[model samples]
Target: MLRRSWHHVTRAASGIRWYVHELMGDTAYAKYVARHETLHPGVEPLTERAFWRQRTDEAERAPVARCC
Candidate 1:
């Protein structure tokens, strides 16, 4: 079942926390988590405010990249 976004941010991180703990024990998943973690250096709780702020910041920065 698909959970609401709020539920995801509030509750899902706990699931991820434990999953990451298990993943950390494995070399491949640990590296994947590390790379994924790097994209957000200080994300916590993943609140709506922070999510929108990051999205807005990315949107503002995107045009300057001039990618095809």
Candidate 2:
């Protein structure tokens, strides 16, 4: 019973961690790489630093209004 309870707790924690990472876009680069490989196997995917720099540049070019 104790072992099962611990397993449940760990699983739930993992799920929460995944959710948080996805929500915060922390997994964007990983997802991008997977899709890029599937869709364009021959092309090299952008480096993580370059990917984020491009993202930031695009965002700056078209600023979105947010109520914060």
Candidate 3:
């Protein structure tokens, strides 16, 4: 039916959006929040700004090889 096909298309588009968000690190905070909730149920996860700052600081502390 047309409704079923439309549903499938919308689901596929949602999945693609999630994948792109993951690839671009836009969902990092969301993932971090989930992980924090799971691992430390009573603790609060860092805000997005704080999370990015921490990530950047850690990366700077331990640089990785990358093509220039």
Among these predicted structures, which one has the highest TM-score?
2
Query: Which residue runs does candidate 1 get wrong by more than 4 Å?
Result: 1-45, 64-68
Off by over 4 Å in 2: 66-68
Give TM-scores for every candidate, taking all chains together and pairing residue i with residue i.
0.28, 0.79, 0.64
Q: Which of 1 and 2 is the better model by TM-score?
A: 2
lDDT of 2: 0.96
Q: State the TM-score for model 1.
A: 0.28
> RMSD in angstroms, all models?
14.1, 2.2, 2.7
Report how far off residue 63 is in candidate 1 (Å). 1.6
lDDT scores in order? 0.65, 0.96, 0.93
- Which of the numbered candidates is closest to the native, going by highest lDDT? 2
Residue pairs with backbone atoms closer than 3 Å in model 1 (clashes): none
How would you encode candidate 2's per-residue C-alpha lDDT over 1-68 as one tens digit per residue?
Answer: 99999999999999999999999999999999999999999999999999999988988999688999
Model 2 residue pairs with clashes: none
Model 2, residue 62: displacement in angstroms? 3.3
